[model samples]
Target: MTLDLATLFFVTVFMLGLGGVLLLFAWLQNRSTTALAWWGAAFLFFAPATALFGLRDNLPEFWSIVVCNTIYSLAYGLLWTGARVFEGRRPVFLGMTAGSIVWLLASQFSFFMQSLPLRIVLASTIVLTYCLLFVWELWQGRKEGLMSRWPVMAMVGLHGLFFLVRIPSVTSLPFPIGANSPASPAALIMVFGPLFYAFALVFLLMALTKERAELYQRRAANIDSLTGVANRRGFTELALRVIARSNTDKAPLALLLFDLDNFKGINDRFGHRAGDRVLVVFAKTIQQTLRPLDLVGRLGGEEFVALLPGVTPDITMDIAERIRDSFAAAAREVDGHRVSATVSIGTASATQAGYDFDTLYAVADAALYRAKQKGRNRIEPGRPSLTMVSQALES
Candidate 1:
């Protein structure tokens, strides 16, 4: 193995392509919209690194210059973007990236036209400074957390080292690569080129995939194990946002608070296992009854909340009443014996209550309490159910 620049470039591009494909698949799985930013780096790596040799030598100076200029710039950008994707911000770095781009352009063209010591000096300064910055980024990443992702940090560090060898010497490849490259012992200009970028692409894809998995895991944590609907925390988060936006748009919002009626009796009569079955069945019935804009969540034992955004009071009430009737019709057969279940529902309309989400929840809760007081298996508005009270007084 000659370990030449040509070989390094080829392997580097190949690795970058592989990384891009992996990252694209991972991002697609998560449906992250920002993942498109990776296409810039992936586009450059579609060809093998050795193919870049022809571009460096064959084309005019400007294209060649652009080619090498973007090499480490894209590498660093990938590291930055990966960090941003993981932590929502770029990690710290010690190098001057603007100077490096200027250096790459100067280095590619200096040999073609003239001998410039000042150019060499400036380029070397950029490379060495970037090396120091790479060390700084690694040190900072270790000290202020993110130590667990050292391999990701190392990907950045190696990129700086790529600049170091490529800049000062301007004629050699990195260590431990290009063992059998055709460009090895052949092309001087192809040394230490985009190999580091390939390194970055792979790491970027891996880091992005890891980020998606973590997000999915976090989402799963906020879901109820039994019904697989959003749990109380996720529901509250969704409801607050909906309420805020509904207020802003002057749109209507509705809250539905419902609980199983005599659920304790079901547990005592049929066993808690049967009670759980009823909860699951009741959840399914409500899910089937909801509109696309509606969100349902189990707050805790036997308690549930629903947020209906952009619906009229009549529609919301109708939907709630339908869910109530449907739940009543659902029969659970345990050990060849059929059992019936019912729910107490209380609803509050934001059109009537004004813009406060907490107020809506409170009013809905009060309504639910009213429903329970009047009789189980009935519906109540946030305000007192005067009709039920009137009927009771008449009785």
Candidate 2:
């Protein structure tokens, strides 16, 4: 059974209204995701805009055609604004209203008012621009790795393509822009396409919000709040996986254990705020020194760890030395204080320690203890145990 245009319009209004309320309620639960509020408002606007378009024959041309279509444009503009807001960009109020302004201005022209195809093209182009803008904003934020983002992009892109197709297909429909009597292919697309799109996008947008919240929760669990590095739990989880991979490939790995020298003295002397600054400084230094693939984490206060895969013992020693020197230099003046903080690092290679996180960690921790005993701000290499030595001799 086919749906008539009037019934389709009613369904669109009801669905859009329901979708709008759900989105707004979701926004109330999490005010940080302001994109939901904007998107909700856009859907609300569509409900009334669809109603006005449906009642075009009974209502005045200004209210039904011009104003209704202008609301449509504004709604699409709001969607684009929501996309920008989702990616932490400022909403362009003027840009959001520009489509409505353009529609209103063009409606005043006699030539524009008389031509049905021209009106369809202009309206479609306006909505298409916002659709493409939404896609572009999402594309720019692809690094965030949200699963829902891809489908939203594809949906908006296809919706935009539909509008582009609508421009050329408008020639086939009857003139004067009355109610779709028989509902031609273009008319059916006009009504049904948005109906389905609005329905699907509501669920997709909710999924996007859920995915982001989950991602943030995961990050919070794993990341050090003070230093913005992986915490102990996060490091352990990631490092173990790396170790397993190294073992499988028979590739070498290195672990560097770092401890700040006289951390308690610095905290007691300068206060905890200054101590925090020192930690941040050292964390930043190590992250800058290491490669992107390298795992750098703050195990706890004044202690950190780095796991480097596919690296030799000599290279690990060099990296540890570089990190030690960099932290010492960088922590000299942190947050405008005379915080001459220094780090002691211990290096361990998988060739000696074996490709197990626990084994590597034990060796590195022992080396760290040695560094503390020798003095502070020194790099020490872990010595292989007798078992490892014997295995090496046999090999």
**Which predicted model would earn the best lDDT?**
2
Predictions in order: lDDT:
0.64, 0.88
Candidate 2: Cα lDDT at 384? 68
**Candidate 2 lDDT tens digits, 1-395:** 76687888888889988899999999999999999999999999988998898788899989987999999999999999999999999999999999999999999999998877788889989988999999999999999999899999999999898778777777764432222233466456657766896789999999999899999999899999999999999999999999889988989999999999999999998999999999998889999999999999999988999999999999988888888888888988978888889988888898887876766887889899999999888989988687755554454
Structural similarity to truth (TM-score) of each candidate: 0.53, 0.90
Model 1 clash pairs? 1-179, 2-179, 3-178, 5-191, 9-49, 10-49, 94-133
Give lDDT tens digits, candidate 1, residues 103-210: 556666656335433433454455455545544544554544333356655655665565465454533332222222234333443433444545554565466446
Worst 10 residues of 1 by lDDT: 172-181
Best by TM-score: 2
